[model samples]
Target chain A: MSENMGNKVSLELYRTQLLARYFEQRASDLFLENLVKGTNHLALGQEAVAAGFGVAMNKSDYTYCTYRGHTHTLVRGAPVAPMLGELMGRECGILGGKGGSMHLTSVEHGAMGSYAIIGAQLCIALGSAWSAQYLGTDQVTTVFFGDGTTNIGTFHEALNMAAVWKLPVVFVCENNLYMEYTPIGKVTAVEHPGADRASAYGLDSIIVDGNDADAVYHAAQDAYARARAGDGPSLIECKTYRHQGHSRADPGKYRPKEEVEAWFARDPISMYRLRMMENGFTDEDLTEMETEIQNTIDEATEVAKLSPVPSLDIIDKDVWADGGSAWRN
Target chain B: MAQLTYREAVAEGIAQEMRRDNNVVFLGEDIAAAGGVFKATVGLFEEFGEKRVIDTPISENAILGAAMGAAMTGLKPIAEIMFSDFLAVCWDMVVNEIAKARYMTNGQVKVPLVIRTANGGGSRFGAQHSQSVENWAMAVPGIKVVAPSNPSDVKGLLAAAIRDPDPVLFFEHKSLYAMKGEVPNGEHVLELGKASVLRQGDDATIVALAAMVPRAVKAAEILATKGIEVTVVDVRSLVPLDTQTILAETVKTGRLFTVEENPRLCGWGSEISSIVTEECFYDLDAPVIRITTPHVPLPSSDNLEDATIPTVERIVETILKNMG
Candidate 1:
């Protein structure tokens, strides 16, 4: 279990976690300040999964996620500027400012796309995996979903098909212990859905401490290797938690204050940062990284603020690839 | 010139496109071994092999969803839905995802997928197996709905839809699959929005689509025998309707009849009537006529089902009445 033969993975984890933390904290502040409008699902406490898996993933590999995708986008190499511009509804955003926070994409970085609809990306990712295999490519796709999505029909169908076809996919379950407000225990009778069901499909699965960046990085490395080798799909259940409420508007009033405080106690970013220091990272070295990230985010925010908004004239465009024009009217 | 059945032409088109591009592949129920229930994809499995001509489980949603994903990732997929009526089960995959993904992504992604299915009422397959649902797809944005009535049109449009960079719902009428037509021997492709005039006349313009084209052709023959000339227009594609030709014909004839096998209310005929009325109101000499099935489920009995859908006799009688 302790594959910590070196400190390289731990350092990379610290880097990603740092990005996720600063990114979400800035987004949360902007949302509260009314600069960032619309629904914002901050991946505050769940930075470890995105950063850890992203660090463990190859450049050719792909990642698909649910509405909590800002962290995924940033970890997958999306520039902070265009992403911030997208969040601000600027034309230079990833989705051309059409899709806000919920629907963000940077296919060039191997992040196929993200969707707001729960469990929708599962089937889409499976299809992409199928394409990869059919085209005789070594690329693999990692599809991330919440514990709540495991109950959806698409989740079961996609998994079943992926298993039968042995698609080059790694299904990642970011079990943050809550789907909106409902707890995992309240919904699923099985303690670990990903691992338990993966065995039924004759595929390998594992449960890892999602907060432990090294653990996620190692597990993801295994899954990605198996998928790229055409050995079929693997499932990883990352038992993590979201530090903030599901969206920015809610205060998570349904859960007790102590529970939120309890999760906040095991903050993935702070834990990774401590690990970085323990591994001989100097205070000045950490400060330089922090300052660099801050300055980059500042420039991104400025670019997003100045980007033009898409006009309504072109709103009716791109409805169809050909000039057939389905939504012209 | 070569004579081929509609199903044969469709399979030929698939084979032709797959031969042209390595990125083109196909999948559907029994499409591999069984060669499809209608045999539209017959011999494709052997020719293309399992990786290209895949036989998927009886999950319509998975088949369509996987095809959409494949298309997005750089492959052109031709998916078979068996029958058009089963589209109801996979509506979410077709309408919500496949039809809207390109637009939703602001054209960043191109879902070059063709959903080929047997449509229209014939062979007494009843309401379940036999029903025209082209209108349902035409209502959705981001999708090109083309219903080919003849073997030549099938090959041309199927190739065109496969080559195009959009999600196309290509409906091959169940009755027309076996109907023979003269098709060119060499490669041929049809444009999506162009309508082909089957026959020319001066009294009235008879606009028809899919299976109704043959019926309207017969009606035009009858109208000619009675010295009442009727123009017949086959609308190859419904979504991007050939409004230019339709309006031109309607303006010259000053009378029109829209024929379809779907229900009369909110059918493609209704849309044609609305568009014609809006654009050619000044040239109208008589109210537009629509020949469609009754507002009821398709009957199981052959005679009963035939009575519901527009027929050659029914079309001829309607045309004569409009001539008044």
Candidate 2:
């Protein structure tokens, strides 16, 4: 994959990364202003991971993400208005306004879900992969988790099952360096948290410099091809950094200011923009992309605010698929 | 009529379902080639092959989540948890993920899966393996709980459980595996929440669930010899408790006995007692009698463990004492 602006794919890759950045900025501003209710975890520095996976995956492929997953779902093509509506607690949100930010799901786009529990999505992704295998479909499933979730038991269990059954799945650990304020160095024993564990399951691990969208996209594409070929699951540890605190409420005082500044210098969006410029893209072209993304975000916010909250008459709605829930009389 | 053991009945139900629907698959530890610890899933691996009859690693959490995902993606998976005591291993997947997915996602996903586990303690399987956890299933919402008594009920209920478009916990008693009875021919599917009235009488109503149903029927027979005509009602499914059958029977005799294998305090028996009391307290000639296992961990010793569980004599004695 060429990074030069002469390649339309590279331009789109830059567009995706920027789209994530602009969306995060808009979401961050709205959340800080108290317009977006609940605790929304932002993916400011991890834009390449979500966007690159978006670029690499096939339309039929499934993606399961963590709570910091607005970018993941957006990259998977979830409706922007409903995604924003979810943050604003509107009835028209992706999850009917019940799941808030942590549980946005778009089954149509193969964006399975983003569970709040650390390693829970691992099992869910493995299950879907098992389904694809059992039904003899060529679809591949990818699960995104943070470095913190690698410590969870389900991570090992899901990987083991996937290895044993040769399930068509990819375990993508976005090494954001911090597991919810506690730094990875303090808790994890190995330098490569997920890659070290991959050998234990008899699978090879692919370590990628996560800041580069091209690298991640290529790695994920390779994993998809391998999985679709029935070679079993692989672990891709994307070494990335979290720009903001874990959530809106968390402060970044725990990190060394110098380390934070160094990581910010290698920011994925800025790096991609420079590559696009060197490849002969004009400043106006980048500005046009940013303006278009901003309009999209703005319209989503407006549409969400215009939508009414769900009616009280249907308060006990959707509790059961068979309508057997008796929570309300 | 052919006599089918409880295990055979369950296997038959699964086989019939698999034969009927290609999506119905059986998965658990030792269930594939080993054919389940109690042989309940015997010959299924040969019949359905490895694809449907999956042998999984000893990871309940993964299996439960896998079953949920498979169910969501067009497979009706029947996951066996080996023992009901092991339900704790993957409690969150059931209580939080599977049970709450439908409601949390606003009914976007229906958990069309069944968790079948061997329950109860009659063969001295010890504390870890011998728990009757019907209360645990009842405590969680958005999931159905079904415990069948005999071969016929097991066959029907297991069939119904796999086909239901929601999560169902099918508690099969290990003690009743070898217990044989006449099962209906061919395909059998029972309703989810319906209860079967084994016997009818006016003196009193005894509500028994799972393996306790036969014992209650025996106690009722013993009571009849002593000039008592108590009705024996089999409470097949707990979550959708057949309150109509229970209410009608309890209202007829004005006396109800809630019997189960769980411990006495705050168990499913108490839930039934409260349900009857709240619905028709005035109709009761006596306080609802709850004949449950003693509040103690099951002992491995045969005699001691038997003493902890409610016996046929104990049920007869309780019925006689509670007689108005």
The candidate scoring highest on lDDT is 2
lDDT of 1 at B197: 93
The TM-score measured for candidate 2 stands at 0.97
Q: How high is each candidate's TM-score? A: 0.95, 0.97
Per-residue lDDT over B1-324 for candidate 1, one digit per residue giving the tens place of the 0 to 100 score? 799999899888899899999989998899888988988888899998988999887777778878988888988999999999999978888887887776666667778899999898878988899989999998887788999989999999999999988889999999887899999998988888789898999999999998999999998998899998989999989867788898998898999999999887789989899999998899999999889998998998978987899999999998887687
Off by over 4 Å in 1: A1-5, A322-329
Task: Evaluate every candidate with DockQ and list the scores.
Answer: 0.52, 0.57
lDDT of 2 by residue, B1-324 (tens): 569999999889999999999988778899989888999989999988988999999998898988988887778999999999999888878888888787777667667999999999898989999999988999888888999999998999999988888899999998999999999897788887888899998899999998899999999999999999999999899977888888889999999998899987788989889888999999999999999998888998989988888899999999998785
lDDT (Cα, tens digit) per residue for candidate 2, span A230-289: 999989999999898999899778999999999999999899888878877788988888
RMSD of each candidate relative to the true structure: 2.6, 2.0
